[model samples]
Target: MHALIEFPSPFPEEPGVVRLLEPPGSDIEALRARLRDGSYGRPFVLENGGLRALHFSLGYVQSVMKISDPCALQLGYAQRMTAFLLFNPRPRQMVMIGLGGGSLANFCHRHLPGTRLAIVEIDADVIALREQFCVPPDDERLQVIHGDGADFVRDHPGRIDVLMIDAFGPDGVAEELASFEFYERARGRLSASGVLVMNVAGNKETYARHVERLLTAFDDAVIAMSVREDGNYILFAFRDASFAPRWKFMRAIAIELQKRLRLDFPGFAQQLERGQALRLAQRLSA
Candidate 1:
């Protein structure tokens, strides 16, 4: 839907927290009329035609869930984020920084049963919408922690299998989540073969900056998958593990995953190959 609502600024500074506590499907103007005190970011749900979506602002959709199929990923960026599976189809543990609408959280919990998933969310009020979004109840294999994502990684122990960072607010990626220091800490938190997947959207300059940070942090082992219409970019960065995908092998795996997930994974394989070629061309030109 990035930021175009009659809504107020979402990422509020201290002593000026904003809160909206109307039921889903409530009109934005009505919610605006009833603003109160609460968290740093406020999220409202939109229900339309058997689909429900979460948003920090009116225009930019944060997460979407099908009412008929709650575990379904309704956003292309979310689907592309799962391309990390091409590298590690079976991960031991998966962690997500943002819990907006719980699209990734719900998908991994339902599809990847053996993988334990931990989701870190900075907004407590947003966490309160777990039931609304069908985020599975915290169990042995799932935990939704209400905390800052940046700090969570900073103190997290090593050997994480898959780390997904989708945390965003009305303005876009939070500084703490995009800083070089944060990228370094993220790399430090991964296992030898762990893959870090980040979903980010920004202008060309901003996009290039994020890529630069990731390349520097992961020692140039990174792949950028850009969604067509939106400015969204899904980045996959490898840990110390060696990774040079053979297209033949990747396409085979993509075909299998496409049959299972019903997503455009074969297309993802091609996208990865093309992204690699473009990077190679840039390097050679340099």
Candidate 2:
């Protein structure tokens, strides 16, 4: 049977749906086990099929990873890049570890206008599924490299302006993506002015630990809040360890930045500030 559920958030219009489809007598945990093995659910598309995104539901996890217009996720990544890297007007090259629905790659291709974008995806099936997700053809500025993200970044000796790690396994968070060595490789590939951004899912402390690993390699770390509660968080690390934004300026920037991206800016900034405050408060309380 099919069950539909909705998530309430500031951005109610975002495309997301949860389904519980299991045969009679099947326990939710049993079904979740199946999903953990990566063999459940069918392909999903929007009403018009205009957006390139996919979601598989197997009666497990609180909610399915509904990449509402994966292209939007891609554009969102580019917007984050705009906020951190491109805005500075430095020469730019972007390396994305996970192609997902190829939204970010396509976004960089169309918008950045002059940025070099390379996407490394481990799944060939996922790569074949790109056309369904609206990924365009190969071009001089855009290249799709099929390999492990860590391997690609490690093997390459050249510098990159921005590196985005959004890798997720069939079950959940990919363990290898979180290792200290991976951050070391990412740090090595970055130019002195480069920034590293990772899409991680979990609570604030869980997110902080992930950022902390990068902190070992890099001097500074900043987190960009997600639009929705209990969703993925973006962690950005910079080469120089001392990057700090003035609270007043950050608030203003978040206000102006809200209009530039797909998320609710006010909420995004507020949550980020709150998380930062909690992090600081805890440090002092200790």
Candidate 3:
């Protein structure tokens, strides 16, 4: 198991300044090797006061865990993914494609006692570092599988109530996991009233292409919320085309969830409402 490595703050002394620290002993050959072999890169952790961040690439933070509150959702996108609970407050089976620091997985395991959680991560190295992220042990309710996300969904049909695809590499989302076929397979893996949440990143063209594929597969039953902190879009796709969203009911549910989960569920509901409005405007403009 890869343990968390604490390093001094890489930020400049001045306020409002942030800097990325290069990994020790990293060079062109090492980077090339990492690109050639997915398992080559070593995951490391950085601590700045109470905040600890996990990084596979020095350029980006893969996950962040607060030392004081490890189970809290540290990133906006992580919190937004919980919007699935709004659609299905009591999901029976949930599958997560990526397990970076196990933020979402941990949150679900701790809060959704009745739900069965399964997380699939392609990189065993990341899985080895799960303990550093405070991910819980595998039990009947929660299990982590080291395998390809695309293959997992293809094999498991009509078993998932909530399917989350956040599988990403240093460059961007994995090619196999981003294809239209994979989206269709993900849809197949979901039970009736299932919700698919994906974390997508890239340039505008690339993002649009991926969103288009999801829209095509789900027949436009999709709404996207943009996380301004990291410029990543969290897309919620529903398996039931007739699943109508009611903001009033969602807000009420959010309040109940917020009280139970200690998250900003009401705010998240508002974000989804805004996303729906944006999608409607875009369609009208087209």
lDDT of candidate 3 over 1-286, digit per residue (tens): 4333233333343112111223455454544445335444666555666776767755667888887778899898888889888989999999999998888888889889999988999988778878877899899999999999888888885589999988877878888887899988888878888999999876878668888989999888898888888888899999987677988988899999999988888988998998888888987899
Q: Which prediction has more favorable TM-score, 1 or 2?
A: 1
Q: For candidate 1, lDDT tens digit of each residue in 1-286? A: 1222333433333122223454455576545543333221468666666777776655567887898998888888998998988888899988899999988888899889899898999888788877888888899999999999989899887578999999878777888998899999888889888899988786777667877988988888887788986668888898873578778988889999999888999998889888878877886898
Error of 2 at 156 (Å): 2.0
Candidate 2, backbone clash total: 4
lDDT of 3 at 86: 90
- Where does candidate 2 have its weakest 10-residue lDDT segment? 3-12
Whole-model lDDT values for every prediction: 0.80, 0.59, 0.80
Q: Model 3 compared with the native: what TM-score?
A: 0.86
For model 3, the stretches where C-alpha displacement exceeds 4 angstroms are 1-40
lDDT of 2 by residue, 201-264 (tens): 6556655666677767664355454534345666767655555545666666666655655445
- List TM-score per model, in order: 0.86, 0.67, 0.86
Q: How accurate is candidate 1 locally (lDDT)?
A: 0.80
Residue-pair clashes per candidate, as listed? Answer: 1, 4, 0
lDDT computed for candidate 3: 0.80
